[model samples]
Target chain A: MTKLIVEVQDLWKSFYIRHNRNDSLKERFISLFDGRRRERREVFWALKGVNLEVAQGEMVGIIGPNGSGKSTLLRVIAGILRPTKGSVTVRGSVAPLIEIGVGFHPELTGQENIYLNASLYGLTRKEIDRIYDEVVEFSGLEDFIDVPVKNYSTGMYMRLGFAIAIQLDMDILLVDEVLAVGDEAFQRKCLAKMQEFKERGKTILFVSHALELVSELCDRAYLLVNGQVILEGVAREVVACYHRGQIPIRHE
Target chain B: MGSWMRGLTRIIRYRELVRNLVAKDLKVKYRGSVLGLLWSLLNPLAMIVVYSLAFQYILRIPLENYPLFLITGIIPWNFFSGAVIASSEAIIGNANLLKKVKFPLEILPFATILFNFVQLLFALLVFFPAVFWFKTGVTPLILLYLPVLALQFLFTLGVAFFLSSITPRYRDVRHLTEVALMVLFWLTPIIYSISMVPGKLQPLIKANPLTAFITVYQDIIYWGRLPSTEMLISMVLWTGLSLGVGYSLFRRRQRVFVEEL
Candidate 1:
């Protein structure tokens, strides 16, 4: 049996929605003296009782409509956001490609950015040196390696971002809609690389709106709605359930 | 591992990321400007000119080599103020990365402080030429500047970590820091000699944490002697207290930073 790589149990995350613009310290200081200076905040639950489990070497896609807490769930699993009332435990390191080119500076050269981005993912310089040529080659930005990234075309920019992200040595890679940026050929290359990773027994947690891609790439899928995991099963079955408008009844 | 050991290991592992981030900040700082890195030197030089003219020429201070005196205090002051001010916005400014990436939030402030430290090193390059040209009486005490610098760095790091954690929730912290720094600047003896202050005011001067650091710089760089025993002791105490308070506060508050942001 494949080992479980990610185990999230009954996750809940809430955010405060301030009713007034008095969140600033200056405003708070004034509110202390003025009787009429009242500030209010409402709690917003982004994720309510979310539970999920992904096995080792499985490509699990989280599908949900906009503002449905898919991204929040991914962020929590990646350890970026603390859950309000649940535990998200992953067995090993996570490389989060939530947004391409996260720490990329526009002024730096492509080579420089590749180093910076990889280092952010926790790759040592020696490890980066080993993978530098492969990343540059995969991005196909050989001629522009020395040129600053600001001058590169949008496609080149995304290609570089994707290349650096995919090359990191991680046990589980958390991907979130990053593949939507590049062109068709680049997307094909990315899919091929994903296939390679799957073959190498690396677990993948993918979040995307692309249903066809989900059914094609993922071994199993999760459907989330209104902050809860409404359905989970075989990839095509879950996709069909979502298409049939079979959102689970809201708990509240 | 113990919590402190865990923290130490985390920082040790992320040392490369810190180095790269620091390098990126330095490069981005001077990337598009015409004067580029030279502006780091020219900025403090301009401050010296203005302050020297205002105090030495206009106010008619009796002290000789007044510009040198001002530079001594000013250079280190710039490092402290620059790190503290930048750190207040460090986490808020990197909301994008904070929202997506799962790494130490403390790295943000640590990297920002280190960035300013690098710029201060460059500014120190300018100081050496001024020191040699003015013939500010070289001595063995200059070697002692390293220990003092390391202590100041710890104090600055502690404050940076604390401020960065707090700023996201208290957005006015950024503004308050600017005003506080301005007030603190005048309170510290950067532009004038400590002896010039009246005897009654000496104790007041001693109370300010920055006074010890600025005086240490003034001692080795200007007076060419070791810092007084009292100053050294206060430096260590202040460094320890600031680091202890700052780090604990930062640790307590870091978990909620993303939500606040």
Candidate 2:
């Protein structure tokens, strides 16, 4: 049996909505002492009692329609967001490619952002320095490395983000449709890297609407409808099942 | 690990981020501005020029080295206020960073103080050139005030961290701080001489930490004298008390800060 690497149980998250929708000083004052029911915070449940278990070295895909709990579930598993009720425990380092350039500063050069991003992912300065050349070569922006990331194109931004994330040496990779960015050539390169990672027994939990790509990469898949998982099992089977149900993935 | 202790360690581990953030603050603030760092020097100079006109030219206080006195007090006061305003929004301004990333949140406040510290250091460099041009004699006792200035730095940092933590939840703390500082600035002799105030106000003025802190600065830089023993002891006590309280407040709120964001 494969060793268990991730376990999530009864995860539930609810966000309060302000009754006054219009955020203003006068409205704020009126709502201050009013009854909470009268003030109207309609609850938005991002995730509802999600439970799942994944073992080491498994490549899993989460397929969901718009407003499905896929991203929220992944965020909770990555420890970025707290579940309203439930717990998730994971073994080893988790590298999340949620948004590659999430923390990149515009004024700082690419070299500086590499240091910033790698460190944000918990790599020491010495480790980043060691992989510095490899990351640069991967991005294919050697000449423009000195230039600020603000000058980078969408493809260049995606390339650099992918390079840094791929170098994390993490036990588990949480990918969220980041591979959809670059050209067909770069997309193949990313898939090739994933295949290489699979050879090393690294676990991957990916979220993508590309059914063909998901089946090509993930051995198992889960389909989420609204906030609940409606289907699970072989990727091809689940994708077929979800599409037949008329579910649409939210396009970012 | 407890979130507070974890935050402290994370800051030490990510010291470079602190440096980068401070650099970012200084760079962005001065960028696209015609005056550049001239703003730092202009602040104290403008206040000194106005005070000289109001006091010597109009009120005729006949105070010795009055402009010099004003500059010394104004320099530290500016640093104190700069750290205050910078830190009040440190958490709020970086809400995007705080929401998605796991970092030692205290660095946010620490970086705010460090940012102003760099600006204050530039102002200090300007002071030295002016002092030599005016032929002001350098004294060993003046150098002795280095420890006192350190105490002031600690005191300011403590308040900034404490306020940064509190302001995220109770935003009124910002407006409250502005009004409180306005009252506190008057209590400080930034524009006028403490000697001119009535004897009854003397003890109260001395009790005011900023007043005491600035008075010590004015003595060493302007008059080339040592601060009185009472002032040194009181300053030390206040610094320690403020630091302890500030750390406690930051420690309490750090866990909920992620949720708050």
Candidate 3:
């Protein structure tokens, strides 16, 4: 059997929504003396008992409605969020394109942000140097490379973010709604790059609301609802099930 | 022990991130200004002139070449205060990066301290000529400067880690750090000598962690003599204590940083 590259077992994650937000020391101190001033919080479980596994070279899609914990799952697999319970074991390095342009400083030029953004992904200076030309070329921002990224339009920003992420050579790619902003041609290019990654035997965990794209591109998919996987099987079947709107939407 | 080793290796691997961050800060700070790096020196020069008028001419501080003493103490103290105050913003300011990326969070505060450190070095370069001009005359003992500076760097880094870690949860830490630094400036012997402090308060002044570092700078640069054993011991102990407490706290609190942010 092919080796499993990503294994997440019985995962759980929670966040606290604070009311009155006593973030300052003064409020915290005052809340101590006055009973009505006490800050209130409610536990928000973003992911509950999520279990998943992906073998090397498999393209897996995660389809879920808004607030169904899809992004939270990606964040946990990327190691940006800690699971409140359970374990996530990945055998290789992961390049998370979750909300790209993460480390880009607005004051820095496009060329500078490439270095800064790539380094945030754990790329060394030499590694960035090797790919610098390719990144600018791929993003097609050669003329504006010297200009600060703050001047770039939203499309240009996403292109640069996508360009930098795709250039990094990692074992697993966790892509979350990154193509939502780019134009048709750029989206085609991103899809082509991902297809190339799959051909090169790289594992991919894709999260998107594009049901047609999920059915077409993913080898298998999971439909998550209320923080649990309600359906898992062939991508087309899951997409059809989701299209039928058969899953119940849980209320708070 | 294994986790500590892992953290060290992670830091070594990401040294380039720290360098990039420090470079970014320097570029952002000086990008629009005409004087650029010379601006860093202007602060200390202005302070020296004002303190010379107040402490030397009016208050009549008994020390010879008082500006030289102030230069040695004030510049280092500026570095400590600047780094500590900036640390409060290090983690909170990068909430976007912290939420999206998975690189070492420690690098945020570490880079902040390094940025201030670069400024301290710039200030020192401009003022070293003033030391010779005052005829304080350098001694071979000045060779200890780099080693002592390394200790101070580690010490400030520890405080940076501590402050940056807490500031995310408690927004008031930034204000608290500024007020505390203002009080600390007076407690430290930056403008005045320890000898001028009341004898009963001598031990208390000596006990201030900054006193050891500043007094050592004075001993080597101004007095041209070896630092007393007690001064050396305090420097090491303070550095050790700060790193031990600050880093451990940072490591423990860092887990919930994204949640806090």
Candidate 4:
């Protein structure tokens, strides 16, 4: 049996959106005496209670139609967000490549961002120095490394971001749709790297909409609908169910 | 360290976030500038030239070593106020990063104030030469202002963090900040000497915490005298209280920042 690395018990999250109001302060003041409208109302629950567990070295893919709480669940697992009402127990160091280059400074050079990104990922300067060459070489952008990242093309930016992320040595890696950003070759490279990570026994929680990638990479998968886990089983079976729901099958 | 404390300890625990944020701020600031970070010094110098032109050339406000007085007063005032304005928006501007990355909320405002302090240090390099040009005598008492400055920085940070945390919630607060800053500028004795204010007005200005702090600053740099014991107590107390309250508010609201953002 694989060692368990994460435990989730009935996680729930909701948001209180103070309703939007139009009309200026003056208009509101004028209407106040007549009671035109006082306070706005309502709350949105982005996630109902959600529960799941993934063992160490398991690559689990989470698929859902939009607003099915996939990203929210990923956020809670990464500890970037708090669940409204449940316990999410993560056992090891978790590195979330949630978004490509979320902290990249526009003016800083690629080399500078590498250090900043590495530091943000909990790596010390010395550790970044050790892996600096590997990061740049994998990024395939040695010539542009000195240039400010603002000068980088989308591909260059994604490459640098991916390079920084892939170098992070963490037990649990939460990958969002970052691999979907770059060119075909780069995407293939990212897939290969994820495969390499699998070989190295790093656990991954992959969230994406691509059925083929989900089936190919994830040993176990879940189909989420309306902020609830509607189905869970083998990846291919889940994908088959997901696609079947997408297009109606006529019975003879 | 204490139980009454709520948020500052949390910020201390995430010290890495603060360091990275400070670095990110410093890098992003001059990133687009052609002169790079020289922009910080250029701003104070430009202000000095314009103020000198107005006071010395046009109005002819005749006074001995007047340029020295203005530079000493204006540079710190600029640092303080610039930090206030910048810090008040620190968390709001980094809303995206705050929502995405789970770090201490105080890190954002701390980073803002820290970067401003760095720029203030740069501005000081330009400011010190004028002190000697005016031939002001250096006294041991002048060194006393370092602790005073450390206090003032803390106070500004506290106020900035407090204001920034609330500003995003009630956006009308941002519009009113300019007026508050203007009031603070006049109260702090930036453009004029403390002696110039009437004796009755002096007490009122002294009552303004920032003015009391600035008075300490000008005392050492201009008059070469140490600030009185009462002034020192006031400065330290103000920094402590503002930071205590400001950090608390920031800490309490931090978890909710993503939704607010």
- Show where candidate 4 strays beyond 4 Å: A21-39, A246-252, B2-28, B31-34, B49-63
Cα lDDT tens digits, model 1, B205-238, are 8899999999988999898877898988999999
> Which candidate leads in lDDT?
3
By lDDT: ranked, best first: 3, 1, 2, 4
Which is the winner by DockQ between candidate 1 and candidate 2? 1
Give model 4's DockQ, 2 decimals.
0.33
TM-score of chain B of each: 0.96, 0.92, 0.97, 0.89
Q: What is the DockQ for all candidates, taken in turn?
A: 0.73, 0.28, 0.81, 0.33
| Candidate 4: true contacts recovered, fraction | 0.28
Q: What CAPRI class is candidate 1?
A: medium
- For A1-252, candidate 1 gives per-residue lDDT tens digits of 779999999999998887765768878889889857767779899998888899888999999899999998989999998888989999998988888887778899999999888877777889999999999999999999999898988888989988887788588989999888789999999999988988898999999999999988999999988888889899989998898888776666
Model 3 lDDT per residue over A47-72, tens place: 98889999999999999999999999
The alpha-carbon deviation from the true structure for residue B186 of candidate 2, after best TM-score superposition, in angstroms, is 2.7
Q: Candidates' interface RMSDs, in order?
A: 1.2, 3.6, 0.8, 3.7
Residue-wise lDDT of candidate 4 within B22-71, one digit each (tens)?
77777677666788779888777887788888887788876567677677
Model 1 chain A: ten consecutive residues of lowest lDDT: A18-27
Q: CA shift at A15, candidate 3, in angstroms?
A: 1.2
Best by DockQ: 3
* Model 2 agreement with the true structure over A104-202: per-residue lDDT tens digits: 778777888888777776567788899999989988889989888889998889999888888777898888989778999888888898878877999
Highest TM-score, which number?
A: 3
